[model samples]
Target: MSSDQVKNEIRRFLKSDDKLALCLRGKWGVGKTYTWDALLAEAFGNDTVSPQKYAYVSLFGLETLSDVRKSVFEHTVGAASFRETKDLEATFSSISERVAQLASKWRAGIGIIRGVPVVADYGGLVEAGFLDVRDQIVCFDDLERMSDGLDLKDVLGLISFLKEKKRCKVVLLLNSDALKEQDADDFRVQLEKVIDINLEYDPTSAEAIEIAIPNRSTLRSRLVAEYATTLGITNLRTVFKSLRICERLEEVLKGYDERVISQAFHSACLFAFALYQPNDAPPLETILKNRPYSDLFGNKEEKTPEQIQHAELLRRYRFLKVDGLDLVVFNSIRTGVYADELIKREADLIAAQLDLNDKDAAFTKAWDIYHDSFDDNGEEFAQALKQSIAENAVAISPSNLSASIATLKQLGHGEGTNDIIAAYIGSRGEGKEFWVGDPILPRFNVEDPDVKAAFASKAAEFADNRTLEEVATSIVRQSGWDNSDLDYLDQKTAEDFYKAIKEAKGEQLRLLVYGLTYFRNVGNPDPRMSSITTKAIEALQRLGRESEINRLRVSKFGVEVPAA
Candidate 1:
């Protein structure tokens, strides 16, 4: 029912004294009881209004009809006297006053009913405190949670008695979805006979959100509602919890712009919904690639069942292509790493914005400053330098390259430092100028032998796949051989080239030797290349192959052969 219809029905139920019961049933957390209580508060001004009594009893663990009877009697008020009273105490006082008046009319030691002695059963009278629930609004909550031994027909029978005999306005607040299979079937069969009105407690989205997040004006609340609706989230508990997470995120992400904050909020909502709702979240890669979003909402032609499910999951959340969020955000949603990285990156950007000097390494330099300030042993400085170098190498920032190189000079022999340096140099063009001058490497370094061989073998493989000139050009560009700081790498490459020729099989050996001769003359003019050419000449001559030697001299190098 619409909120208006439900409201009108509840209003009618409260005002009318008809011998009928109203059943309010819904899925969990859709605010069924909340609505009912709101209505009660509206009608009575407070729960303890005079005379027209309100009783609430939860049948959650009631084991038998006796327990139900006791609960109703205890919860009910103003049963006997029709006069309005302030509280249960006033109602009990009115009953007690009537008893006193009757006691005054009787003799002190004798009581009679139909000329016989009347013995009062005090226990029974106390047990039956207030069963006459005339003019009372009684609610039986958590009906689905009622004990297994308390049969459904039995509970309905009690509701029937409250309406027929007690003349009370009864309401059954239940989550039918939670009902056990047999009980659910039996409840359907039995509720029909007893219930006068079945009002399925269908709360609207706005109503649900209002109940879940009372502070709807806040950005966190607004975003949660928007996201819940977009994702098509209808479960009030999940919505409430998701909004709570957003509230926490808002506090933590206070400094970021709304766009960034909203992104984080949205990501958090996706994660929360996936946890709370029924979904088999696809792998992070699938979401990261936009495949899931595409399969459901994009132009992707082929669709698998898993992809379809992923799409539907997003759709249920009202996620559409027009939302314009990056696919990577979904990845961030699934694994916290993405969001953490985003926050870190944003922090860095913000810090950079606030930094007075365009190049402030104040935080990074703090380590050095601390060591110098203490005049401590250089161990701390050395360790700091090592960390700075390693961090810079992996990230390879042009801004910090000079500082990193200076640190590397002190900690160059640290594990994997050489590889980092090699990779840094290897990434540049052989002729490209270093951002800092060649004195960058104070301690001359040897290229790792494994690195040298791999470079050579890879170059040879490239030669077989492409022209030798192209291979030479590519390696020279990549290895930064022209930079004097990296000349040793050129020499190492030449040596590795010689080893490759010796290990190469017949045709590959011929190609390796030829490629080396061309590299000597046409590639970087390092003397290492000249030495490698000399070695190739000697190796071919030792092979007693004049043809190969002359070919290296004329066909490749364009140099005249010295008489062998």
Candidate 2:
């Protein structure tokens, strides 16, 4: 049974005033030790059980045999001399003398002891008369680790003896992985036949706490957005081996559980996307644990600098929405952020802080709030961003640079100047300030993204439920051009693409037609493709023009983990 069920069985058996024994078996790293530690703590604190009456032990490491005998003698007699610890007394005369001494103790014990020796610490406790024989609980751990391998006869004797006790509970705990699969089966079979109750580990609650739940509903989305943003700059791509990276991060940042550990593993895969972001990359030298906080307006709690940066990235991306407020990100490469909503929210906050008039007062104080100590190297780090904008891109919005930068850094992916600028700007959005320079970037001949959109729509249709030929035929029909002028498109390739569009029949032919159409609608997508050529017609034939290329490159090398 599962851990919870085992705990339940233990609870039920306890009501009978029986000595309870529970066996917990599982692989070592699967959380056996961790679960038991938690269960023991919770069990003893339960109102129904008296803590002093129960104890736990590992059979393999109890103590010297000599110490065991001494303890047994003391407990049984209420007090026993060190000299009387063993009937053998180091130098026994013979077996006859030992038997006689043992009989003498039974006689002396009969009058002094009120109850039979039914309860014991271990199997050896039977000889010491410590077994209460009626009501008690004994938990044994690591019994498999005992020096002398346990024999079948000995196990049978122990089970039969416990059954005879009738009112005792026996608990056994094992790390399943430590044993061979063969021996494990036999042990489990034996345990299941005798155990009255069983339990398994419950780490979900603990794992939840480690990730800081309850507060998560408010912050998890924002956190994920920021994480995703970082992945962009770092060029995170979908790859299988990334599992280990994420797993370790989760263990370091949160805690471990089967579910949480699994997520940590996947997170590493997901972060590959963030790792390859084109702009605002994570600090190259420092670990995420040491990264600085980027959020100027955030909780001043004991959070790492990276966390603050994460929060700021969320705000810039609009991944986080302020309740009861309309937010907008405006750019001004010269000045800084401009938020219509924040201006209103903070306008009042500033007026209230300064105790200004209610009329034009809010705006009057808002101006001071906007420019308040806005300098380089301040806690907000406002000046650093402002400087970058002043030097390169414009700070188009006073709203939330963090969110804008985050979005641009994630989406504005390219190579060289155009790519760096695109990634930087795309983090914010495809807004007007982010227009491509004519020389470095070419404009799509088609005003509408319809050509590319049509390809995706049909591709989805085919993927869901359609034959390849049907999809090919459908695409060919849609991609056929009705006009001949072709406008400013690359002359030679455009004519040939139009000719190919006329002759195509199957999937490959359809793909070429689609590629040409997409080029007509969207600029060259692959950064690597630029080195190949920019000819509108011929670029369609370029290899590896997939939009996923930028992300894949970034992921492989993590040059960009967007921080904005």
The TM-score leader among the candidates is 1
- Candidate 2, residue 540: Cα displacement in angstroms equals 37
Q: Model 1 compared with the native: what TM-score?
A: 0.56
Residue 176 CA displacement from its true place in model 2, Å: 3.9
> Once superposed on the true structure, which residue ranges of model 1 sit more than 4 Å away at CA?
46-51, 77-126, 279-290, 293-564
Stretches off by above 4 angstroms in model 2 are 1-6, 27-47, 50-52, 61-134, 152-160, 200-564
* TM values, all candidates: 0.56, 0.32
Tens digit of per-residue lDDT, candidate 1, span 1-564: 687798788877776757578898888778888788777666665333323776788998889878887667656544332233343333455444533434434434355422422225322433445444456678899987888788888889888888788777789998968887788888899888988899987776677776777776777888888876666565788887786666655665677766656766776777676666644344444433443334346675877888777777665654444222333444444454346455546544545454423223543673555445757545566566555544434333433443444444555434554565556555544322333233235422323344334334333332123333344344444543323322322444434543555456765654555555544555455666566566555554444344665445444434455554
Least well predicted 10-residue stretch by lDDT in candidate 1: 430-439
Cα lDDT tens digits for candidate 2, 37-82: 4454455445454222333445564344433223322232111112
Local error of candidate 1 at residue 286 (angstroms)? 8.0
Q: What's the lDDT for all of these models?
A: 0.59, 0.38
